[model samples]
Target: ALYYDNGTFFTKDLPKFQPYEQQANFEYEERFKRTEGKAPSGSARKCHFCLHRLNAGMLPACVTTCPCGAMYFGDKNNPKGLAMQLLAFNRGIRLKVSQGTEPRVYYLTSEVGTADNLKACLACHGA
Candidate 1:
């Protein structure tokens, strides 16, 4: 859920039982200045699940280059896929389940320290 307010871009965070948190404030103008006043297409600066790569039968860049091997991608309905196996084994949860959007993304819960560590790494690595 990326949005533009004034010249800033941000995304809303979804928690299991808490209110949505607005996270990741980024300057729209500074980030997209090269476009020279043209509006960007698609979901602004958000991920579109790498449709181009997926159509080409390749993994998304994020999944392929994840330093910690934390990301996985596969057909959700495929019983033998690693993503499905992990989701079932770990009891993965999806965001905004009540919305009935049936989002394909699933998250596996982790310790607080593990999440903090990942955040630090992403901050430094520009993920």
Candidate 2:
């Protein structure tokens, strides 16, 4: 996510960028070496959680656009909302537990690529 901080731009993208890009390139090279090693087709665009839409009570475009029905969005305050329910029922994990930024987006622990232990999606007690 990008944020304004007194003439500076900050985002989690910087840490994630190089590793992911290099990994993608490595996979592509291994796949296409016999055919002249063309880079894999992928979008490197970064996305901030859509604050505008969230403020307007609508889900982010990516959530709605997910073709596999993998994304869920709802008011965290509503204990009955699907998102809240998921958070309650499933063990959600932060993308990076070590940083302790207390991320809002979390993955179900059952999900193969989730973190080990992290606080609530909203940093329940406090930041």
The candidate that achieves the highest TM-score relative to the unseen native structure: 1
Report the Cα RMSD per candidate. 12.8, 15.8
lDDT of 2 by residue, 1-127 (tens): 1122232223334544333333422232233111112223332323456666666678888788765456687777899988888889778777876788767777765554333223333243344
Model 2 has a clash total of 0
Model 2 stretches with alpha carbons more than 4 Å out = 1-46, 111-127
TM-score of each predicted structure versus truth: 0.57, 0.46
Error of 1 at 87 (Å): 0.9
What local lDDT score does residue 114 receive in model 1, on the 0 to 100 scale?
66
Worst 10 residues of 2 by lDDT: 28-37
Best by lDDT: 1
